[model samples]
Target: MNRGRQLFGTDGIRGIAGEFPLDPASVYAFGRALGRWLKQQTDQPRVLLGMDTRESSPTLVMQVAAGLRREQARPIFAGVITTPGVAWLTRTMGFDAGVVVSASHNPYRDNGLKVFGPDGFKLPDQAEQELEGAILELRQAEPQPLTQLEPLAPQSSLTDAYLEWLYSHGPQLDGMKIVVDAGHGAASQLAPRLLTELGATVHSIGCEPDGRNINAGYGALFPERAQQEVLQTGAQLGVSFDGDGDRAIFTCSTGRIVDGDAVLWLCARWYLEEGWIANPARVVVGTVMSNFALEKALAERGIRLVRAPVGDKYVLEEMLRHGAILGGEPSGHVIFLRLATTGDGLLTLLQVLRRVAATGDDLATLVRDYRPYPQHLINVRFQNRPQLDNNPAIQSVVEQAERKLAGRGRLVVRVSGTEPVVRIMVEAESEQLAVSTCEEVANAIRSAIESG
Candidate 1:
């Protein structure tokens, strides 16, 4: 519930790059604030910096590094790397903090900044609020000339280290035909090569980054492209990663899209059967956006589902608090708390493949039981967002919808953390009911905005 943050959003400060909050001045101030905070924690604290393949990433890194140098903090450069790669390195390499310059699934024209603590997780809200205060104070301060900034070469050894770790730990995909769509982002090189080395027949698309093409008609946002490829090639499976490689969506051999909910079910069943879970019936953490059918299926198996607010960080928090090992979002941000501190597309994909290989089941067959309820979601853009909970008209409309559903459905309405929009979701036993209920709620919100 923390408020009054001017720059930092739920997923970190994101916007069209070279604009407010991402321009040279604001970015440098943010870096300086972060460097000072690290210095406060410990003198000479080291920070690991990584970025995706956006054309502006290199310059942004240089500007941020310049600010870090001012506070005597060491910045280790990891160029063109995935978001989770920075998080993993931060924990393994013992850096005080890690910074990833990526907008994730956002288009190339946009960019963002995400910070991982020494524990390799996103910063807690209190810490982020404190950092935001410092950043705003420094916003008006003088900015160093971009031309005067020196380019920092990537630590080639660190990249090699990450690759080695993946090879040593991840499952071998031998004899499998897998198609990977990197979305022309951070995983452009690593994903295809890693799968090939693991003995999989790898076919790669969207691996070429022209800097401007990241997430262009590919990746999680456009999984249909990967589905088409899977069908055309008759591949055993297909995976598509977001711009920063933190999340992924999969396509089964039958061209069925397997989202995070299905993946969670697959992993939960695997761990339960494998006797890997310490507690079999405690809870599996997921967002409110998770399909209601997932909850029902798990309940039939004596498993409980705990719904956290949207965001992988919130899911991770609930996992830690509840001591649950499995949790993720439907958007393919799966978190294996035992393996990683954040959502990792590559790790999740490999784990799914490993489970398939071990269970001797096709991906589609394995997830056949996860027949999701007919859910409809709509996003309505607004110029100024008002608190829906405080609006009597919106609340009344929602209450009416709830009574109509009468325990046969669910409704979720909230503001987008990253964009200026309100999201409405409805899930029911029938698509007609779901779509009609969802539209009613959306229209109410739209009317509220218009009236305001």
Candidate 2:
């Protein structure tokens, strides 16, 4: 066992299925650990369990449940539901905790566990550290072999209940032409149905999930497929959802991609124009990954942009901290704090459509005024780990680069949370300046890491 190693990342515990962290022993231990913690919360702990369409998800869920059962805790299964659905059900349907057994955008071979508390929010880092400590201790006393685990059939009522609640917040879509790509993940069945039920002429893609096809050549990460579908179908707009349906990317009728920043600007403008707040602070939350264009646009409208760390969890934290109603990431996860606990592709699309419908403007028409600032990104890979924030040499290099910026734009250098690389982003007044500045930072980082 890898003792003293970190088990949880920004999202949750993730790795290649059947490996150390996700192996049977560790997963079972994780369940027992979570169960033990839940026991401290209440006498009878009922955990809501959900997973994406991964071949490995069922066994993992079984292992977790069995572990929980061993600790006298109950695991309430909501089989093959979206991540947000589990969160919603956990908060609204009275569960002590919620566990999502799927890697949001990873391949079939990879999987993860995301835990949510009673408030439909992901457990904080301190709580995750506590769970990791418990798991590490319990893994030494691994249990015996388990019995046969059968396939799970979801209670249709549970999924239907989620859709019903989502529909309640959606506007009418009568005779509206749209394209939906569910990425063959958890939303494969739900996205199309929701659009159809709302009276939209829907052209669907990526709705077939064979357990291994989730996020393969589809989803928000690959919006090209959805864009092609939209162009071919001649639909008014297209929406592509990542696996687990937590995030979404959109395509205009013109086949141009509408990312999260555009969605934010559109939504923020609409919210203020429609009197969502009386003399509202008009604070919108964005991640460090957000384009500088968004910041400038919001500032021009007297709206303040507060940049949080990389994760959507952190974004929500900032939203709650500032009491802001809207926040999101460029990766297509937009959080409408008032409507959904976390980011919901469906909820975001509904809000975007409401904005467009209210203004009688097309997606392209609405985003035309928001020009993108020139930004360049460079990913520098290293042999050893790079503690970007803690490394004095790296920090010095970064500070020098910041001085070069001269307040014209922004520069962000951080280790990629999900990959083994350092991402350097530079946003400047010109594309040449952005590219040069980003390259300068990337080279300096390489030198610093190599020398150190």
Candidate 3:
């Protein structure tokens, strides 16, 4: 395992916008490092930059852009765009690389820098390591004042090209009433407009971003509001996107929550039925956090379920390894590798909506077959980084907990890649058992970590 990668987490270099890795000096160095690396790949590299609606995003963009400019590389601005938007534009528009100045689903005070290659895929592990080394060396030297570069304006043509590409893949929905929740983040301005242009009657929520309000009361994780809005608006579907718009969640017209697992099953079923997949026995990729019943449903259809680590990147890697077209996380990061290089919430919703129109069935009816096992999740915060997957104290408690399950259920204890917390998930046939085991494991984890 490449534990040497401390700077880059599962997603990217994430932190409070003004702290350590995200600080003005460090952020600038990061940009310079990325620029220098791009220079090595090509002369006068054209790097695409985009950001979320966070108050910190603009400053970070300027810092990174200054750093890129210092390295004699050009930064093309795609201001206030989704993460996938930058990736798609980078690959399709002949840019050497892309960088996003938003932390997906993180609060407005927090931010990150995610780098993508020309193919719209994230930089591989080795590439990030090289950049991190450069960033560190640059940061250790005398901190130079951030340069005030010329103001950058977003190229409207780039945005139009991306929207056109996405629209081309989606089936038009004429007269379909829809509810849109953009989480007051990257999709705040784009999602509602896109849906309206697709011929849907759009009722938008969470569209007002006040710099600090992104994900405060609205996002993919908060479905209650979308559920209520769906019921009240009498819309056929309700979609909620995350802070960066790469993840999404859905609610049915009946206010029923149709989460990522249901999305997976729905897509798998469509692929199998349409013979889009050569054999029904193909595999679908999911994370360890995926519901066990998702595995069973796929198995019943002669399809195999492969579990990757709990990250969209890991799920994408597994998809590539297995040649799978479909993969997703329970947190709403669904990747249709056939269409997109990453998990695009907008694209995923479009595909699901297309499926709905094709089948003439609502979300509830389409996902009625996926009965998930009882699941309980508990997150334990730490004063410092809590040890896991290797610490003996934690391992002992986990071993005891697994024995308690005795093959009747599953247990997953993992550290959060984005936050300083350890999450415990317990799954069983009964909710009571799931909850109790989860509490037991949570207490053990807390005690073990605290005692040390």
TM-scores, all models, native as reference: 0.96, 0.92, 0.97
Candidate 1 structure quality by residue, lDDT tens digits, 194-249: 88888899889999999899999999888998999999999999999999998989
Give the Cα lDDT of each candidate. Answer: 0.89, 0.87, 0.88
lDDT of 3 by residue, 163-253 (tens): 8888887778897998888899999878887887888889899999988999888989798888899999899999999999998899998
TM-score of candidate 3 to 2 decimals: 0.97
Tell me how far the alpha carbon of residue 126 in candidate 2 is from the true structure, in angstroms, after superposition: 2.2
Instruction: Pick the lDDT winner.
Output: 1
lDDT of 2 by residue, 261-315 (tens): 9999998888888776333567899999999899989999889999998879989
| Candidate 1: stretches off by over 4 Å | 143-147
Q: Candidate 2: worst 10 consecutive residues by lDDT?
A: 143-152
Which residue pairs in candidate 1 have backbone atoms (N, alpha carbon, C) closer than 3 angstroms, thus clashing? none
Model 1: which ten-residue window has the lowest total lDDT? 139-148
Question: Which residue pairs collide, candidate 2?
Answer: none
